[model samples]
Target: MEWFLFQLFRTELIHREHPSSPMRSTAQQTSSEIFLAAVKRGAKRRARLSQKILAAGKIFSTPIASGNGEYLIDLSFGSPPQKASAIVDTGSDLIWVQCLPCQSCYTAIRAKFDPTKSSSYAAGLPYQSCNTSCQYNYMYGDDSSTSGALSFDSITIRTSTITNVAFGCGHRNLGTFAGAGGLMGLGQGPLSLISQAGAITSKIFSYCLVPLGINKTSPMYIGDSAAAGSDIAYTPLLNNIVNPSFYYVGLTGISVAGKAVNYPAGTFSIDTSGQGGFILDSGTTLTYLNTAAFTAVVAREAPRRPTLPWCFISLVWISPSLPLPPENIFVAVDTLGSDCLAMAASTGFSILGNIQQQNHWIVHGIVNKQVGFKTENIETI
Candidate 1:
């Protein structure tokens, strides 16, 4: 099997809809699964955001896509190489998978990795002093959790085979990861796949998420392979002091119908304290803004409309012939025949979700701490 230390792979989103038809039913179930996973991820993020705010003045100033469905890619671990598909997530760190001798686990579509079978599997990590046997336990917003031992083994990605790569050998696992074996977290944390890749990957990656229901392969590139051209627009990646794990971007203002809306300046500012800003998250399905900004945008986008959902519906009736704002700022939900962007109001921070990121080339330059966006269709090409 060929693999790259840093490789590029194509992925597709799954949808489950229409119970009458078998294919459609499967797609519908997949869609529901994706939606539920996204909701749980959103709730988890919101709770973390709230925790950061509550701990602000005190000692604990803390913490805190691509497709309408989950983004998955194939990877292998161990010496003999137990190959399995894993979800590519940017919201959380720590790449983990269910291992064999399972005490309890979800109904997996692939064979689980057995550390005992791999000749290169090391039961303990050198980083530990006394209890070198690595172990981890994590819980998510949807009440799902996983507990397992850490293993240092050979991991193969295409043509590149890396040794001593640390990953979780999950024994007790649960949650929405049914069709996939585990999650490959690409978040900006210490334990993420990107971070673990270390000098081999050059701290860079890029992805182009296909729209929902598009049965095509979307691509993800690592290292120098993620090049860009002049047609791409670049945005400065901002830092959220409280939540360094997220990819924050400066969102100056939003415009509608080719004219700037009447929202205040500091609406999306990142001050010294890292309060009030927006982040681009691939795990989230819908864009979200502060309640104030969301309300104003809704009012202007559909004036005389009382509620947000109603306003969105009203936009569908508006003449498409009318010129609209640039897509990077305002996204039109064509599936609903509506000009309204699929965004909502939040109390903590604004989020640029995968819904708005569709069909765009998103480059994450972790080394430079900047993110670049370009509008293009890599799927068809």
Candidate 2:
């Protein structure tokens, strides 16, 4: 069997609708289970996101894509490798954990960063030469602004002992990221733990996740030659975007209340970096929509809800019904609201997140410029 590690993030902030409800129903459970069972085949998935990040409690945080963050990972650093609470992200790839000296390591309720701890502590960091020698000064807005110089140390998870995790050490405070310790930049570069490991040797790095929206049945796939479904649905990649080596997916179509509205048929882009709004990002924290897209979805979802309100949480919203089951999924919410109900608009459902992609097999063909989306049993491609 192959080896991998799971990492978790302690997310405390979210932008969700304000309404509350009882626990998910058995019917919902049945649906979720059916969807997830098909997605999870022979792989194990770990937690990869923070527990406190969701506005509507853990449910909203369920099926988190990239917004859930890297709560777990494949045993790259070499340690037994902790469990994951992940948000399968793609915009970037540099798996790491919050270490000690964590001035602002996410919410206090979540895991605290302790540098003094980790038996694998390898220090002698140079913080000043970051932007010039490192990536950039601007971390993503969604990321916890604890920016600083990137570290060139070896971190070992269990499955594959990754050296030079591309992990960043924080400054005295969060210069950019809101209040998080450090981040695990997971893309296709040295920043990626797997990719970095691959650099040292010739091993390829990859990963996957199990979705809660799928009733904790489906397993998202990463690394190796692992993939879930056959009769999958895939959309072609757009003409232009950022990095071609990115774990890019495709934009199938965007609908408003079951009505298909064309955004030029090829306007969507997939980013594992966990950047951007709701239109194409599966790994983002919130389901942000462009003005036109948001308007259309909201109008269809909550026709009766008020247009503008004082607080973002007080709005009524329509939950989107999915054609596919959950699993093979990642959920998203509003700006950073603590309530999922508030983020809902007149759209048939909230932004299509981990909830809609349930039971579907998704593939981030990093080497290719396309994503493969497939139903567990039905091969769309």
Q: Which ten residues in a row have the lowest lDDT in candidate 1?
A: 314-323
Q: For candidate 1, lDDT tens digit of each residue in 297-370?
A: 77776653334332222111011111112343334334463444557787656777775677677878777777
| lDDT digits (tens) for residues 1-381 of candidate 2 | 232343211111111110111112224333334333322310111112221112112233232123333222222221333322222344456444444465444542234334444455344344664434553232333343334444544454333344435565543333322122234444555556435544233322222223343223233333432434344444443332333224433334454424564443223333343332223233332333334555654555454234323212111112212243211212223235222221222121123333343334545443343445544442121
Off by over 4 Å in 2: 1-88, 94-96, 101-143, 154-158, 171-182, 188-190, 197-218, 229-280, 284-352, 377-381
For candidate 2, give the lDDT of residue 149: 41
Worst 10 residues of 2 by lDDT: 13-22
Model 2 local distance difference test score? 0.34
Taking all chains together, the TM-score of candidate 1 against the true structure is 0.77
At residue 216, candidate 1 shows an lDDT of 59
- Which predicted model would earn the best lDDT? 1
